[model samples]
Target: MDFGEYDNRKNRKVESGVPDVCKSEPCMMGIDEAGRGPVLGPMVYGTCYCPIAKSSLLKTIGFADSKTLTEEQRDNLFVKLDAEKANMGWLINILSPNYISNSMLKRNKYNLNSLSHDTAIGLISRVLELGINLTEVYVDTVGDFNSYQAKLKSIFPNIDIVVSKKADSIYPIVSAASICAKVARDKAIKNWKFIEGDLFHQFDYGSGYPGDPKTKQFLSENIDPIFGFPQFVRFGWSTASSILDTKALPVKWSSKKAIENSIKTPVISNFFGVQKQETVKEKSHKFFSERCLKSVKNLF
Candidate 1:
């Protein structure tokens, strides 16, 4: 696999096989994602493309829903795809935990669903932009299946898109994408490196899921004075929220109501109430008027 950063450093893109899909006949591709539930590591979006007719080649290699396969099985399947690079190509988008947290915490408010949609769309758009003659796209849905399908259809009106439940299990190409995503996420978790002077290691955090006792314990114990946990943890998650609220310095928030209440406003009398008028002072006599100037000239 070739590893590199996307134009934006927020995410990394990995690709395998340098097939010229444009020159060859049209092909079908699949898109799927992994690690959406984990609070640690990156959420990876994976895409696999191959000649539609050669899809049987994928089935022969035992590609299936990655969740059903053991870690070793997934690793072996990746090796198979690597060996058959000439026939199949795959790509992945690694959305780091830092990236995910920052995006979620932005003032504009980017949710996970939108992030996932954009990431998947980006990968598919990238493949097509690379001049690949992609015909059909199959994807597993994270939310409303129909809504996601509609979104893809609007983007690729010329191509066919199938968004369904468990597409990774139903479609061979999707299963291949699942393998790529799952393997990439697992590798990221396994190779996680903490920065210098950090007291905690990746193992101390377990799988980085909120339900994991180790992960919860790590978040509970590692609350920083200002920054919370290291970059490995998602500070925007509820787990971090609870810890910061309870253990770290108390965070005070100014709500709209509180601000409005704090502002002072002068009371206004009723429109029918009597009004007070200012007394008009008599016009002060001008010092040395025309008559006074004449008298002064006579004296000179």
Candidate 2:
């Protein structure tokens, strides 16, 4: 519940329970994300796992899709989940709005779907790293359940991976993951401390979706003539960028032409449009392709 850690790192995790107990039993894990569609706060990836036999206990506590639960009900369930710490574990990965915008707007265009997949994979990897005897994983699908499922399976060949359109509703573990993500995101938004000096002071950004009139009002009212938006806004989102392009002053980068040449196109980009159509792709280092690292011209 501490925002201090999150304030320091745009990306951070909240972990509950240690792994020693999990190492004794076969575990089932689930992952779901929150705030993906919002033009506001961080997009969060949540994961929770328990002994396969104890998963039924999750259903007993009324873990269900976060969207269906009232804020009070979700809060109550979040507390209940923590009370079950003896047999369950959970982790939340918070990807800040700034990080999301940076990744999506990077010269190579990292894109959301790729970011989601990578974040989900990283969560699973974290569970494994903590020494859990993980055997199964359930995921709420992001794009093309079949392809996404296949991709997860390929990376984690030993685990039984299931990606379903409504896994968050169908699986108690996935629902629990949704609760983890939703509650954390809500807390993050409520306590957000703008490093950008006082502009407007309020937590009235509405639902943070593009369609919300209050959110529209907030974006329009807060726009800076020279700078695009505060870090809280996802500057790369079409919802935010479309406004910036029309309202904010234009800024240009010097490395508009070239930087890392050896990076190859991400496979997920083939499914979603993240590539430059007119610009011919440049080849990347074999090491870069193999390790997902890119050579930067400068550290700054």
Candidate 3:
């Protein structure tokens, strides 16, 4: 929860100790994401799993909608979650903003949906590899509900995959995951350290949503003109990209492939393949050169 070195761009994971239920009996897991809509901070993927027979215990902890709960309320729920560590397990994957921007902006263009899918798949795969007896997976839908459901089923044919509209609110395990994700995201943003410079030591950038007035003002006031916004912002986002296009100086970058292709090659370079090019010589070798009497093998 400390989220030390918040400015680091690396992706990271946090998890609870393996629950006894998961290893001993068939389990059901839920997957949910947080911070997907925010213009700032890392997007988080969280998963929770427990014995199918005992999953109802999660509901008793009042793990409903995390968005409706106060910060203190959510924190209390998270504490309760740890108390149930013997019966259930939770894991989180934090995707840094810079990483999100770079992945979306790269030449091949990894879209957000694909990123989300991969993250969920990876978390489940990791849990299975750890020898958990996961029998079912419930997920809040991404993109098309059925398509997403099918994709997950293909990857985990042996598991019952349920991709629904709002799994977090409907399922106890997913609600647990929702709380874990929200708590981690809140802690991350509250502790975010700007690695850019001292200028942002105490500046308040509220909410980190594109529509938030404070966040908008903070972004507008801090534009670098030459470098655009700091690395804390997702440059690939349209909210930031528009500012760069209109306010920040235009930066046209030559791609690595373009730069490599632009280098001039010598006109004769092709002639020096595996063998060196030899100069023209007398037709009859050294004897013809001395006598100027070239012997023609066949005169047409």
The sequence of per-residue lDDT tens digits that candidate 2 reaches over residues 18-93 is 6466888999999999999999889999988999988788989989999998888888898998888788889999
- TM-scores, one per candidate: 0.79, 0.82, 0.83
Q: Which prediction has more favorable lDDT, 1 or 3?
A: 3
List ranges where model 1 is wrong by over 4 Å: 1-9, 196-198, 252-300
Put the candidates in TM-score order, highest first: 3, 2, 1
Looking at model 3, report the run of 10 residues with the lowest lDDT sum. Answer: 285-294
Question: Candidate 2 at residue 259, lDDT?
Answer: 40
**Model 1, range 164-240, lDDT digits (tens) per residue?**
99999999899999999999988876665554234666347787788999888877877676656666677678887
Stretches of model 3 off by over 4 angstroms after superposition = 252-300
Please, what is the whole-model Cα lDDT of each candidate in the order they appear? Answer: 0.80, 0.85, 0.83
Where model 2 places Cα greater than 4 Å from the true spot, the runs are: 251-300
lDDT of 3 by residue, 62-175 (tens): 888677799999899989888887888888999988788878876797999999999999999989987899999999888999999999998899999999988889987888
